[model samples]
Target: MKKARILMVVLFLLGICALLKCTTNTQPPAADGDEKTSRERGEFPDFGAMIPVAQFLKQYPGHKIFKLSQDYPKQLPGEDKIPAFFKMPFDDKSKWMDWLLAARDYCFEGMIDADFVAQDNKKRDWYHMPWLHYGPLASEGFSGLAKEAPISPYQLAPEQKHPGQVYALGFYNDFAGHTLYKMWNTSTDPDPFVTQGPKGGFPEGTVIFKFLYTELDSLDVPYLKNPYTRLAYITPTFKDSTNRIIKTMNLIQMDIMVKDKRADKYGTGWIFGNFCYNGNLNKGKTMKDRVANLVPVGIQFGNDPGYKTNWINPYPVVKTMINDTLKETFINASADLPPQHLGWGGRLDGPVDLNTASCMSCHATGEFPQIAALVPAQAFIGDTLANGSMKYLTQTDAPAWKKYYYNFKCGTAYDPKKATSTDFSLQVSLALEYYWQWKNTLMGGYYSHQYAGIQHMAIRGGIPFKQVKMIKKRGKKQKVDSLTQTQDGF
Candidate 1:
């Protein structure tokens, strides 16, 4: 009996040991809900994604302008809906034709009607022009007019000092300012500047514009009438010695979008500074007469047919064009200067280098206008009652402009002047603007970070429609519209 009891004890101990081994050897489940072994599972999330048009429409109905533009007669008509002139077969009505002729006027009607600025402050009739700020400084008699002369690459003198400073002038504005933004470069390596604070963001500044007019000519729209002779001025915040900051100018374009699949990168629209080839009006080119002569140079981003974009020479981002000679010179010239020492608002590098235009002056980290890198600025050009008046107003009025001007603040409600730094401002600005215009409330703010940071998010392709047919096509099936749900007669 004693030997049998001992044998039972030994058997129980062995069984317990076996159970422990089984529990310890088991492995946790794979991430991404994969059941496959570690070797068979994919390594990372797929970044190469093409957002479908249907999905984009379903996700963002208001952004799907084509549906509204195409079927305007059938849809509800109001201030919120598509304007009749923009409708398909737009010339179908005479009253709408006159309205369509002033489409840009309609787009800006609220601003004119609001008169957010001076009633007499209208120095020039800039509102009537098709494209604003799209010409050279002195192309035509120092006005924003495009010079009859041909445009060539800028011949900048060598920098003799450390961190040179030059102000690009010609473009002007009133109480409110502009905010240009850029997407973080996802291709080469992560931008070291991106972070949680003001200092932690994409570098941005003024980049001079020096492109051949022949290039601009190639970008002409086929059926559309070209507005300006040439694109000459860029907007910047620089002041004269008297302590004025707005008088400063640069020859740079706002809202440049870059898209590259192979680079594993895409660019959000970015704005920068540059030199105007034309001299100032009185001292060089007078501010009033300078931009007034400006005309439509070319369209950078197209809203039709798959959303194609054309920049100078087909090069997307100017940062990518810096060659060895330019890089070598910039590195040597900027060696002694401390990074982020330029302060929150400092913008300028000494004389421009002929070999390369230093785009980083305004674009690299820590520039005040790097507002877009940290937050979206233009998004607010229409957010408030006054700003929205400037944005959507048709008939200009000064009293209205002032009433809405004070409400314009780049920062948050806590502090509109300056609150949270970095991408948050742009995000918040975009949120406030889109929410007010499209959604009309904070609860319904329709801004999306994904689309906000990626300029090409709205570009897409779809099936072609039949010319003579009366049927609405969905996938491979064609059905008569009257027979669809609305005709079900409940």
Candidate 2:
């Protein structure tokens, strides 16, 4: 009897170990230099069933060709190209603009050495984050344009803002790319925090640039004329159809975000910089002219801790409006940049972004199993006031309203009970969301997605989502919504 008890105890421990391994995480056996070596050796694990995207390049050969750079680097840039601006102190307000400009140029040089027009620069390498090519705004074409945010006709500089949508392509540098490879280099685990634990997040020196192009032209927004253009296959709209179409859109904004430890001293450990395209300033047809038209909109290092004012620069801005009170945000007063429609209380926001939320605030909610919505529920649906501004449905003094303004540390969970933070990278959070959506579709789920509350977060940032239909064992057909199941008030 004693011998039998001992054997049973050993078997019980083994079962627990195996169960923990399967439930807690999925580990990939990759070591030093493995990211590059494995790809070169073509030793890739199947990423499961591949979803198809439109192939307009084969149909129309006249447009400017685009190539999706996928060679993410495990190594960081050397001394010649290091981000020197980070070494400079942030207190020097005189040189803040210069530091931001250097950072912007660093991103541009990192992508294309021959300037914006160079598509074949061998030395310069940039990559697109994988797993974004799924669902409604699925990335299509070499440019990988994903249908993004919807712009209100009331939000523009020249008072000619038109209701239209923008498509964006996000490019990651070597350092940022490595984080992606580490997070998604395997099919066994796609969660950002799975391979790299919840504490592990994007390392310093990571930089990501998003190129935003809009369908609106000079007539719709008067400031947009002779804009830099690209032809990509994209699904026109979710409201209309998911069918792909070949279309030309003009560059309207360039948003750059960099990971730096120094920023942790004041706010989040990242700095966001925005640039707007003014075709009037850059009219030459060449790529150089189009790129030169991009003017610095601003740079943000913090969310101005303990500051929450119900102030906003009304849309249809006829002249520049810079709030003198914001200490963490710096907007260029250059006459060249068209009158800015800055975000909540004049914080950093891009042309394609909504005027209601700052760049940092919207991104603060990025976490796995995204329990928190990007904006407060009040900001989602509101009334259009007389000033062409959207009035918050709820009072700005609500507790949730001030939550986004708090200084959040890197890789720290926004809601500690439900999810792990993505180190303020909404792209990473969205990527994981899409991957789960695809996985759930392949092998059904036990939840009702049609009633899911995650729709609010999935609507604008990601590709369009459609209901998934499946037949159960009892022959009962149930329609489930995409994105996520009801996760609120849990």
Candidate 3:
């Protein structure tokens, strides 16, 4: 039988190499009520079936408090300092030629003037615009607009023309297909840990699009393997009396990229990168004339993926799915029965405090002056409160501000079993065993999440209803209806 046809052709090539190693990387489906809220019930503490990775290695046996080192029990003040500005190599152009020549004289000839406003209407005019931010590889003492300017109301001085502030000085490109989306793709095998960028050499900060007539016309221009780029060189130029340059703008460019994983076309997500201007030198086309200024329209799907699928979108896994639904109702009641009594840091029968917004709701980040961004609030750290009051806490209100905000109701919405009189299912099994060991130390562990879409490209920049209010009444004049139908041929 020819040795049984060589053992059935070596078992059909090892079953096509175990179905091509189980169809390479794929994951993104935990968000729809996250596995029925990590189920666990009974024992008055269904704290989402516990499983804090074997009780977080029996309570941090080798404890590693969010990396700073020296093992840390408490160390701040430069905590063993190390920044000569992150040492070197991000593609060192001689150690970033003095910060890219101070980002080209602090973003050469910059001009930024925008006001997204309306947290509650600080004025009303929603989206006025003028943009540019630190270009010419800034460093010359953080580039012009004196009184110290590293961006922030554009640090005044050219006679300080504050006028409702908003003057961002030059350069921050990201425009390719805009942001980026593609989730998955396969050639048959290839993904050893994913790495590509040569044939057309595009991924260096991503940009390559050849759409023209579908199937990419003949299939080309499709690079991008993990490109994250940011460049800003501006000059919003301030002025007065007779000097000049007072907004004599005409040179702005902002290109932000992401769009690259294409699943056929128009699918994956994230996009925002497009702009070009250069003509004003002294006003012939103003409005900061960069080809008659008018760029706006790029930003996609911020909320509505239901589960997930991975294209690298970690905004801290949406605050770990809202602190695992408030640690599954603070461990249902704090388990351990028969001879129980365990109850460690209980008190949150459901008012909110799934570990006080899990790590200050994204660590909120420093500097506050009413935040717009000059420091304070950057990727993690939410619930504010150092006297800035957004209020979030577990205990301690003694000094000036003491974290407080745990209203865990978990079902209609604010649920997290709340945290207070201690014991609430052992503080939600020690806050999901300290957030599944801090989401297994982010990315490097491949849990994934990073490509921030040009900080909200723009569909009005991250809208979740800040104020629509139109309660009706006032003068009531019900029904009239008319203007219907339309053309068929001019």
Candidate 4:
């Protein structure tokens, strides 16, 4: 009897163990060198069923030429060598439109494929590119503008209203990728102010595209039905274990900045363009046709002094949704929208209310330690209001309004002889700011102290500390201030 009881107990225990194993082993085992756990490498419900790039190309024959270019101009003098195919004259509006469409297709190609996985099967989709976010972590924050005000005084802008939910994915062409990698790799390095080395400035043929999306219900406003196509990728944020379909974030805006010496007369050798999605596309029924909905808001090649700054805005009147209500806004449509609630002359904005900044003005603020701030805290007295109300200073010849209007310059409009050039790269300025923030952290402070101690000892032994002048030729040197010096520039 005792032996029988023991055998039965053993059998029961084994059964329990088997049941536990079955329940616990819910996810697939990771392959070797696959540092990502199952949760980190989110499962794709229809893994193999994703639309392949080749198939997509076949379906949309017009996008056949949208492939990565092997040879692109990288430096000065080489700018002139850029092929006619890549160069669109400022006056040629049709050519610019066609080039932009093709460029968008080229950048988004292969975004749906699973083969392009980077960093532990973190699916690299069109929205989640490798070079953009830097890691697997999805951008965090509320879907739209934050309910509360920002903690930093400098962050007091319309764009700063949202902390993280407004996800942005950036892409660099072959010419710019080389430089991007170098800067990104050293992003965590102790020194924060180093903007240049052997590989710093982007090459002449470099092109950067930034796609900005706003989550549904982001603005607590009713969204237009079928405003944009939905993306295949699911949002990692959800209570249910099953994957929920995250609609392709409403395609608010797309920004394109290019480096070409032909634009050197503007000051930064860069041309900036902003495109806003027109939910009411005349011919867009399919996903491919939706690309046509992106109307060119304007292009800033230079911030000329006398003129109101020439630009092209194909659609001046647009239908928009705010706070769940439908509304119509009048844009300059001919020139870039003047500085409104956000972004300069409204060139740097999307559908959302953001900082008062302009594309070229904001980008031109890119510099090490970011000495010069771009956008002023308050709007100009004669500046156009967000509601499309203007004081008509342009017609009155008022000095104050005229002075405010002249501030609109393209990225290349700055005089290098008078001010230091950031080479038309915001990444350079951001890198330095990142370094400063890192050095101020507790761990950063400890590491910095240790390094400083070593340097002090070296100095006693005849080594000298590297010195940099904080002030320019005409002024006294000033102390290095906060790491957040460039926060308001955006």
Candidate 5:
């Protein structure tokens, strides 16, 4: 009887050990000669690769990509359902690409009302429409004119030190539409900045796409003749009163920011992708066909220390062209085509001077401008000249640059939860600034009439006039200043 009990006890212990092993063996089996499983290797399988191109075409047949010139019908047929589609598995790159193409088609089509597009060019303008307009800096509240020349202080082209040539920006509605409404509804909530939550605060399925253009022609600066240099100084020139010389503005870059819980490991549950115009087109094609010309530079999913930096260059052809260049090609913008001078690690950045700014690094700085006060002054201002005529701000070896880079990394001092988190949304940061400006206006008891005129027009569609009036009243006493500070390195 004693022997039997001992054997039974041993058997029970073995059973417990087996159960523990089963629970612990979560990782997939490693392949031959491989030390780690697929998950351990930091390579989440590309479920997107399994999807065929034909499948994508079948789903989004119209291929009616968004064009800046054309005024698309507001609230397109399938706009509301986009958020649902955006919820599809984030692990697959192919699926994400297809979703992006489709989302671009649907969201862009529906964001603007078609009737608005048909109205009088002067009275019913896309810019005047509330759903789509420039940011606060270019808005009237700052006394900014719609067609005013781009200012150097706000320009991102550090090398050229020239402002945007033909700057036009607009936001799209998605799952986070309600959030946009709530934040902008100043009459109800005057202090929206303090109300915003931490980094990765945006609800899932939120998608914000920003369209930035640079003029290809250099009629303004006749001395800047080189195509590369011309792109660097993207200053738009104008004609007479009767007819403005609409210079060809190339769709230089498009940036997409998405809120995905799958990216939670990165501190901010967000993914960023940037596209560049490759200058290639089908025979007899034009800039209106932005879909074809705009090629994906790459996508950044995370910036965490443990989360491997996975950059997906969807187009192999473009990658080949860029990779073939010498190492110096990346450090020097003039060596390659302006568009080809992508960010560090081949991430897509346009002709705007952002050689040192990665999508994650730039966007990670998405916090209230007030947070800037807490940050060291050296963090904002980069290093001085080393050899070139332009300041050597791009040098990665400098101590200041290193600190700047480290601070922008995921889960760093700059991105801490309490006072500095903007959830990786530049829009959120901008909104906070706007809120601050509004509050200050109230404190001073006066505001810019010109800025109010522009603000009234932009928010007219989304915000109530009563609320707008309240906001304007607050700004009545304060003088509106140019929005000199920029987030996302733009």
Candidate 6:
């Protein structure tokens, strides 16, 4: 009888654990070091994670889940900053390659220094932006990558047949973490620094790097093979997919951006650059050597507002078109760099990015509430004829389309009335979108529900038929429709 009682208790406990994700989470999130008193004083409410991990674990027990790196440094301790490797302007012949190489090395070295489990350790300390694991469009599975864009059948190469999804994951250095800690210090509540805070935005030398992986393999792109691959347990394309599966994704692009205004005479104030993994350079004997195979795509600091080409390079790019006249863009034509369908007449975009948008063109619109669509309406809005010669955006010179190409200074919100600017951090804007949506789901709030982008979340691919008014500086107005999810990482 006693044995039966013991067995029943053991079975009940097992059932409870089996029904949920077994975790050592405690209330109020920050589980150590006088955090309760700090919370009482409104210091750091480290509200751990919002994914409702238990439910996700129950749903997808066989797959892996991400750990929230929310043990954010509440107080930035030192005055040291990442040294400016560029030293001179990015265009200076002496330091140009150094600038691009530094960005590449920064990304690669950081990835190397990260603990094997990624940002899950505080001692080895690289961090992920919290609250990105929310809706169907939020973040998917073990990779914790969000769907950024779709690749058409022949987008990357001629042999390509299957349409695929682009999944991206970005990491912030400790300096950027300082800014994140400040903005989320209030924990469950919106910090004043979020959209309109005096101390909002990253400090001068924050370096963020992202790795973009594609569901397409060597068969699709030909250049992707061997070590440049990853297995993603994500819910494929549109989150509307019922079952999630392990997709073999390949490393296609790595984007690195820095917050510095020194060389940005155009005043947009961020240095953006990316590299394309050239698998043809597969000469290494080890994994690191094979994976280090990258070709510098380009560096972009500002939108050449003066130069308007109104040109879009269609895919299956055979020859690289390097625009020699743009004042703010630079493309390396080395034999090492593969043929790229550059952004908006060769302004600095990577593989997996919409060929119609530049690095800055897509990132400059990072703000809450997403008053402006991430990309111009012409990129997808009105259909184009299949004649192969017509301009996709025939009205590319219109004020609305031109707005995306204009240089907006750092931290200037795209729409001041509805949201605050993240300078050029698209990850922050996307995180806010996911955070608010999850917040509203937990318990709806007046501000959370209204600003959670309820209408924009309903949108999936490109712009919908309906229109929303995009208000610009000088009270200018233009019709805007979201490309997808209110905002997404570029």
Which residue ranges in model 1 land beyond 4 Å of their true spot?
1-81, 88-103, 110-292, 299-490
For candidate 1, lDDT tens digit of each residue in 440-476?
3435544343232212100001011121112222221
Q: How accurate is candidate 2 locally (lDDT)?
A: 0.65
For all predicted structures, in order, the TM-scores are: 0.20, 0.78, 0.17, 0.49, 0.49, 0.78
> Lowest summed-lDDT stretch of 10 residues in model 6?
468-477
lDDT of 5 by residue, 1-490 (tens): 9999999999999999998898779765645444332223332111111123575468546632222222222222344444654656544644555545554554345333341121223322232112122333332111111231232222222234333444434453434544443344232432334324543244565666765555633343221232211111111342221222223344455667776666665455666665554443331233233334445554566432232232222211122224322211122122222234344344434444233345565556555443432112122223323321122222234343343333243222243433444555554555455554555677875444223211211110012223323433444322222111211222
Worst 10 residues of 2 by lDDT: 463-472
Clashing pairs in 2: 136-464, 137-463, 137-464, 450-481
What ranking of all candidate models by TM-score puts the best one first?
2, 6, 5, 4, 1, 3
lDDT of 2 by residue, 100-206 (tens): 78877776763444444323555556666666667666666545677667666656655554566778888777777777766766547555573123458877777
Residue 451 in candidate 6, Cα distance off native in Å:
5.8
For residue 39, what is the lDDT in candidate 5?
Answer: 25
Q: In model 5, what lDDT does residue 393 have?
A: 27
Can you tell me which runs of candidate 3 are displaced by over 4 Å? 1-94, 98-154, 158-164, 167-178, 181-490
